[model samples]
Target: MSTPAPPFSGFPAGALSFYAELEEHNSRDWWLAHKDAYERDVHEPMLALLDGLEDEFGEARMFRPNRDVRFSADKSPYKTHQGALVGSGTVLGYYVQVSADGLRAGGGFRAASSAQTARFRAAVDAPASGLALEQVLQSLRRGRFEVLGERVKTAPRGYAADHPRIETLRHKELMVVRDFGAPDWLSTRRALTKVRDTWRSVRPLVEWLSQHVDSDAATT
Candidate 1:
C-alpha cells in the first residue's frame, strides 16, 4: 500500500488568486504549464492543513481528481482547490471543494453514498446510542456555519427542476461546507479556534469555489 501523507498545517495565502488566473485559461496545456504552481501553492498547503488535522483526528481521505464525466462534457483534470477539517464521532473528517464559483460540504461516518446516508440515519436513530446521536445532532444545531458559493439568480440549465439535492440547495448558491463538531465543549472550542486561526489560509480557496463553474451538476 502507498504510505499515507502527513496532516497539513495550513493553506498558503494567495492560493485562490493563483487558481482564478489558471481557470481563466482553462485547458490541458495550461494545466500542464501551471500544475507545478498548483502543487506548490494550493495542494501542498492543503496537505499541510489535512496533516495537522490528522495529527489530532486521525487519517483523512482525499477525494479522487477524476471527474465522473459519463454524465457531463466539461471534464477538467484538476479541481480548482480543496479544503477539509475534522468532525466528531467515527467520521473523523469532512471535505470541501473550492472552485471559482461556490463551495459545498457534507460528511458521514460511513462511505459517501445513499447507503451511507441510510447507515448514518440508523446510527442516529438507535435508541441505545441516543447519547451519541444527540452529540452529532447538537453539533449540527449550532448553525454558525459557512457555505461557499456564488449568488445565483436562477437554476443552471440541464438539471431537472425538482432534483432532490438541487431543490434542497438554494439556486445560484454553490459552496463547500465544513460542518464542525467535537467530542466535548472544550474540544469543539479548540477545533473552531484552530479553524479560525487558519481561516486566512483556506478562506480564499473557499471563496474561489463560489466564483467558479461547477461541473458536477448531474452527480451533485
Candidate 2:
C-alpha cells in the first residue's frame, strides 16, 4: 500500500515575508540572491498543499514564479504572488492564490467563450435557470463569497435595457472569489480547512456554469 501524504502543517512564516519583499524588489538579481528562500518557504509548501488537496479535488497545477512580461510595460521578472488552478480544467474547477496580502480561493468560469456567452444569456433569460443561478449567488453571498465579472455598462445589445435580470445579463465573464485576508489561521493547518470550505461554498457556482453555460456549447 502507498503511504498517505503528510498533513499540511502550513506555510512557513517566511512565505509571507518573502513575497512581501518580492513585491518591493521584483527583479531577477534579487530573486537569484534569494533562490533558497523561495524554495524553502514558498515553493515547497505550495507543493505540499497541492498534494494534500489532490485526492479529493483532483490534480493541481501551479503557476510559474516567472512573470510573462512579453506584452506588458512592467518588466518585472518574478511574480509577487503564487497561484494555482485545481481540478482538470476551466469547465468546473477551483483556484487558489497566495500573496503578501494573504490567501484567496476562487471557482467558476472566469470568462465565457462566445458560444458560452450565448448559452449563458439564453439560460439567464429562461426563468427557471435564471432563478436557480440567483439562488446560488445568494447562498454564496451569505457564505461571504464575492461574485464578480467583467460587465457591460448597460445591458448587452440584444437584451432589453429594462430587463428584470439585466444586471446579470451584463456580465461578460462570471466568477466567485473569497479572500482570507491576512488571517492568523493562514499560518496553521486550519488554512487548508478554510480553503476547502471556501471551495465547497463556491462549488454550486461551478456546477451552474457547467450546466447552464458550457457543457454542450463548449464542444462546438
Candidate 3:
C-alpha cells in the first residue's frame, strides 16, 4: 500500500533547492529527472499549506506546472514557480507563490474585462469609492505591502491628465505583494502564519475591487 502524506509542517528546504536547480536547468529532460523530488518537496507542501488556509481563506487552486507555449515565444515546457489563488472566481482574489526566491503572498485583481475596467475607472473617478480605494492602498502601504499594477502612460480615454486619481484610473491590474525570501521560518509551520498575515493585510484591496468592479458584473 502507498503511504499517505503527512500534514503540512512547512515547505522543506528541498523545495527551494528544487526550484533553484529548475531555474538553471529548465528543460524537459531535467524536469523529468526531478519530478519525484518536485512531488515530495514542493507539490505536497503547497497542498498542505492550502489545506491549512482553507478554513479562513477559502479553498485555493494551484496553477498547473505546465506552461502554455502556443501563444508565447519562450516555449519552455514548464513554469519556473508554482502559484495558487483563493477567492478567484471574480476578477479579485488572494495569491501566493513559492520558488527559489522564497514565498510571495498578496491579494487583488487581474484579467479585468472592458466592462469591469469601465466600472473600475468610474469608481476611481467618483468621490466615495475613489477615496475608499486610495485609503485602502495607503493603509496597506503603511503596513509594508507594496502596491503594484500595470498602468497606461496617460489617463484612459475620457479622464483628464490632471484628474485627481488619474494614476489609479490608469491601472489595468492592481495588487499588493510581499516577498519573503528563503527565511528560516519557511521550513516550519510559521510559513503559514506569514502567508496568512500577508493575505489578511491585503484583503482590503481585494474587497474594495470586488465591491466596485466585480459586484456590478452580475447585473451588467
Candidate 4:
C-alpha cells in the first residue's frame, strides 16, 4: 500500500524573488550570501512539493542547482530554476519545474536514442500506430498542452516530405509542456493540485511513448 502524502502549505515565502535575484546575480558569491533564504524559500518548499507528489506520481528526484559549464560559453554558476522528476528508471515520466517565469509541468521522452528513434519511426509510419499517435497529439493540443521537439526541416529519409504524418516524422524528440503562469495559487497548495491534474491529463501520452519508443519497447 502507498503511504499518504504529507500536507503541504505552499512554496516558501519569497521563492519567486529568490529566483529573480539569482537570475540577476548568478554567482557563487551571491548564492552563498543568500543561501539561508534559498533553503527556507526554495529548497524546503521543493522538498514539500516532491513529498506531496510521491504517493501518486512515484519517487520524485530534485535536480542539482549547479549548472554544467564544461563546454558552454555562458557559464552561469547555477540553474535559474528547480526541476524534479516523478518516476524511476529510463522512462521520462512526470516532470515539474519552477522558475522566475512560473511553473511548467508535463512529460514525454525529450529525445530518443538512435535505436529508439528507429523503432519510433517504424511505429509512426505504421498505419494503426501512426493514427493512434496523431490522435494523442490532437488530444494534447485540445487540452492546451504544447507538443514540442527538435524537428528536421524535411521528413526523414524513408518518409516522403509530403506524407500525411510527415510533420510528426520530422521530429527527433517529443514532449509536452503545460505552463501554469505565475499566479496567486502558485504560493498555495493549489499549485500541487494544478501540477497533479496536468500530469494526469498527459499520462496516456507518457505511457504511449514508454510503450513504443523507450529502449525496452524493442524487446516487447
- lDDT per residue for candidate 1 within 1-220, as digits (tens), equals 9986644433333455566776677667887887787777666655655566565445655554344566677766555655443442223234544444333344322223333333333432344443443443344435444433333344334444454344212233222344432223211224334554444333433222222221222122
C-alpha TM-score for every candidate: 0.50, 0.87, 0.92, 0.89
Task: Supply every candidate's count of residue pairs whose N, Cα or C atoms clash at under 3 angstroms.
Answer: 33, 0, 0, 0
Worst 10 residues of 3 by lDDT: 211-220
Segments of candidate 1 deviating more than 4 angstroms: 1-10, 83-92, 96-113, 124-135, 146-193, 196-220
* Candidate 2 lDDT by residue in tens digits, 32-130: 999999888778778778887777787887878898888899999888988887743534468888888888898876553677677888888899999
Ranking by TM-score: 3, 4, 2, 1
lDDT of 4 at 54: 76
Query: Which residue pairs collide, candidate 3?
Result: none
lDDT of every predicted structure (CA atoms) = 0.43, 0.79, 0.85, 0.81
- Model 4 alpha-carbon miss at residue 136, Å: 1.2
Best by TM-score: 3
Model 3: per-residue lDDT, tens digit, 66-115? 98888899988888888888875644688889999999999887745678
lDDT of 4 by residue, 38-102 (tens): 88878888888878877887887787889888889999999999888665343467788888888
39, model 4: CA deviation in Å?
Answer: 2.0
lDDT top scorer = 3
